[model samples]
Target: MDSSSEITFDGEQRIGIQKRSVRRRFQALLEELTVMNVQSVADRMAELNPIEGRSHFCEAVMRSQMQFPQSTNVYAALVAAINPRFPDVGYLVAKRAAVRFREACDSRDRDRTETAAALVAHLANQAVVHAALAWDVLMYLLTVYPMDNTAAAAGFCIECGSMLRASAPQRFTDIVGGFRRLLRGLVVDKPLRRRILKLIQADESMFEDYPAIIYELDLVEAGEQVTHMVSLLQPIDPEYSLDSSISSTSEIAGGGYGSDEEVSSC
Candidate 1:
């Protein structure tokens, strides 16, 4: 081959190898980090040069959360902690979560639905996603599929009720009141009925010492917080391909964290 062509080929090969290496490191870091050591984990994740292979990082995190529902809060905390620096990762996570929640609801997979809802609620509490998306999920479950999915709605409230209430007290009151009105005529199981009532009438503080956005996880400030307005009712692009492959041309921005311009959508 000509000298220029040979150099170009060698450079492309190096870039591809570098991307694969970054992807592997991100997956390993995610597996090692747990809720127990989230603070240090967040710091390590930030050091991973995330802008390179960010899509891969996001996919790994989402898959991890899907596989281990019990660690939902840990994943939420990680995202919140990373968001201050790499805001695009936060937006991608939120968009993928909205799509996951919708698919779970459509499939009537109660467990997956609740897991996705929990992720969305916590992300909302962290201000990684707009609160409206969380409210839409709550309203959709209670209003459209109350008989089958009251538990998911109640679970979401339990996960982030205080934040939702704090964001818009009147809207919180209206939605929960409407939920109660709907429950009046329907016959729900005793356990679910009681849980729903507690969510509606009781102070969320009584149930959990730490709010949804735990103090340790509140890494983004009010001005620095970037709320991605992804709605469950809207036609969302999950960017499923992001989960399938890493970009060969991924570049680490010099500024680091919030270095990239605002990514409006996935």
Candidate 2:
């Protein structure tokens, strides 16, 4: 063959080899992701280098969802691996899943709705501690799921709020604002409203500037109840003062009261 033709042939051969190698590696990763054992999948994920494995992790998760559309366990494992390293990718996967859930809800598919709720719940549980991503997922749920699922959506918001209060109080205002905007006109159930109130009460200082917002939502009584509850929970001392400086010091030192507890109680 002429030199020019030989060079072109070599280039084609190199490209072909590269494609095959990528496909093989992807298949291997897929095997690790799809194994019957959840711990095995988690172990393999732990061993992966985040910087190098990010794309592979994304592809594996997307493919896993396609392969096991009904398996919340698989989605949870995949999300748990990706969220800490590539939360944006995790959010994208979650968004797609949410869209699917919305479609199922719109179609009145009971079985599909249940499965979708489970998948979204797993994603929310994995991402709730992450403020930005959690808000995105929570908004998606509130927008997509019907009022029938309002309690679940409210539960997620409470969890997200609790996490933000404990770990990222600085971001609390923005996250709470997002929740307020999304939940403003919706008729939230009494239990859900109570849960939201508890979240606000857990870190009242975070929402101090927005008391009017809470009041306008008809949550004033709930807020008062929380204040009373907190007062009752406090250790009574005649010498103790509710001074701002001491409160600030305590907040700064402990990172916010009840932040270390699980979200269920928050």
Candidate 3:
């Protein structure tokens, strides 16, 4: 090959290597952060500034959160810590989560629905997203799948009841009251009713050990926190395209190191 062609080929190879290395770092860091305590998770997550690989970072966190449901709070905490500096990460996570929740509900998959619901609940608690999204999910569950989603609604209430209540007392009261009314009806099984009631009553203590946003990790101030308004009812584009390799039209120049390629979100 010509000298110029050889030099170009070598440069392309080096760029490809750097991108892969960054992607691996993103994946590994996310996995480690998910299992750590909230405090430690926060401490570690603050080090990340994935402006170039922002979309890849989102993909890693979402994948980890879904695979390990118990670590949902940790993931939310990490997002909360980095959100103020990297608003795109928070926005993408919220959009994907809303989309996931909607898909799970439509397919009648309780497990998936609850998983997505939990992530959204914790995110709301961290103020990464608005509480209205949670209200929409609750209303949808109660109004559309009243019988089918009783358990999901109960779980959502228990997960972030404190935050929801603190944010809007009247709405929180109405939501819980609505659920209680359904339980009193004859249609719901006695055992299920009893179980849900216990969960609802215990809502206050749900976050005692793993609080939604650790005070130390609460990086975003009330005014500075960018709460993305993602409605479950709106036309949500999950930006799944962002998860894949950037095509030529969208590829970042110079191995995608510094450019913040703007990806459209819901």
lDDT by residue for model 2 (1-266), tens: 77766533355445344433433354465555442454454445545543333433444454455445545445564555545545544544555555555566667664555455555554544441233444444555556654555455555444335444544565656655554654576776677677556655644654343221122112112222110110111232221132232233333322432221111100
The TM-score of candidate 1 is 0.79
Per-residue lDDT of 108-223 in model 1, one digit per residue for the tens? 88888888888898888888898999888888787666677888787788788888888788887786776687679778788788877778665435436437666655665678
Among all windows of 10 consecutive residues in model 3, the one with the lowest summed lDDT is 257-266
Candidate 3 lDDT over 1-266, as tens digits, reads 77767534355555455555566666656645533454454445446456666676776676677777877777787787777777887888898888888888888888888898898998998889899988887777676666678788888877777787777788877877776777776587776687577666665455464455666546556787778899987888877775554332223334443222221111
TM-score of each: 0.79, 0.37, 0.77
Q: Which scores greater on lDDT, model 1 or model 3? A: 1
Clashes of 3: 0
Model 3: residues >4 Å from true position, as ranges? 1-15, 34-49, 203-222, 246-266
Q: State in Å the error of residue 157, model 3.
A: 0.7
Candidate lDDT scores, in order, read 0.74, 0.45, 0.71
Cα lDDT, model 1, residue 40: 77
* Per-candidate total of colliding backbone pairs: 2, 0, 0
